[model samples]
Target: MLNHFVRVTGLSQSAQMGALPASYAATSPNAQGGKYYGPDGVGNGALGGYPKLIDPHHNKVVADKSQWAKLWEISEKMTGVKFDI
Candidate 1:
C-alpha cells in the first residue's frame, strides 16, 4: 500500500497528467451557505490512477497522496469545491 500511495502522489502533481484547473471552480464563501456538493465521486474524468484503481479495466494500483490531490483538484472543477489540502 505504501508503494501505491507513493505512485499516486507522483501522478497527482504532474502538470500535464494530474494537475487540474482549480481557479475556475465556483467557491462557497458562505460559512452558513449550506452544503452544495455531496461526498461521493461525481464521475469526473481526467489523467489519474483513480480510474486505474476503481476501474476493472485498469489492472494497476497507484496509492499516492499527491496523485489523489490532483484527482481532487479535477473534482473541484466539477463540484466547485476547493480542497484545503
Candidate 2:
C-alpha cells in the first residue's frame, strides 16, 4: 500500500486524473479553488482525498471542526489508524 502511494505520488497531475472517475475528476478544482493532486495534494484546501471530507448524513463537507473530529474518531476506530495532523 505504501509503495502504491509512493508510485501515485510520482505521477503527473493529468496522469493521476486519468485514473479517477469522472465525478472525482470534476470535483478536483482547476483555477477556481485548488487542485487536489500532484506533490501537494489538496494544497490550501480542507476537503480533498480518496474518502474526501464529507458528511454522509448531510452529503456535504462537515461544517465544524468538532463535527469533523467526531467523524475522524469514528473513522479511526473503523480503520484502526489515526490520520496525521
Candidate 3:
C-alpha cells in the first residue's frame, strides 16, 4: 500500500515532511506529544508525516485530485472493495 501511494503520488518513500525529530518542535499546540491530532482528537491528522514530491527547483509538487482518485481506484481494485472517495 505504501509503495502504491508513493508511486501514484510521486512522493518520497522515506523523506516525509514532519517525520524528522526537528519537525516535532513545530507541531501545533493542539497536537499531543508533538503528534498529529484530528478533529475531535480521535484519529491522526490527514496526511501526517507523508512525504511530498519535490521538483528539481526545490518546489513542492502535490498530486492533484485526479491523482488522488487514481490512487483510490487502485486501492479499491487491489482490495476488492469499493471506496466512496
Using TM-score as the measure, the top candidate is 2
Estimate, for each residue in 24-80, the C-alpha lDDT of model 3 and write its tens digit.
435544334524222221122233343222232222233366766777789899999
Model 1 segments more than 4 A misplaced: 1-61
lDDT of each: 0.40, 0.48, 0.45
lDDT of 2 by residue, 1-85 (tens): 8768756775334444444533453565532233323222364222223323322244345446688889889999999998789
Please identify model 2 stretches exceeding 4 Å from their true place.
1-31, 35-61
TM-score for predicted model 3 compared with the true structure = 0.31
75: Cα error in model 1, Å: 0.8
Q: Say which candidate scores most in lDDT.
A: 2
Candidate ranking (TM-score, best to worst): 2, 3, 1
Q: How many residue pairs in model 3 have overlapping backbones?
A: 0
Task: Give the TM-scores of the predictions, in the order they appear.
Answer: 0.25, 0.32, 0.31
Using lDDT as the measure, what is the rank order of every candidate, best first? 2, 3, 1
Candidates 1 and 2 compared: the better one by TM-score is 2
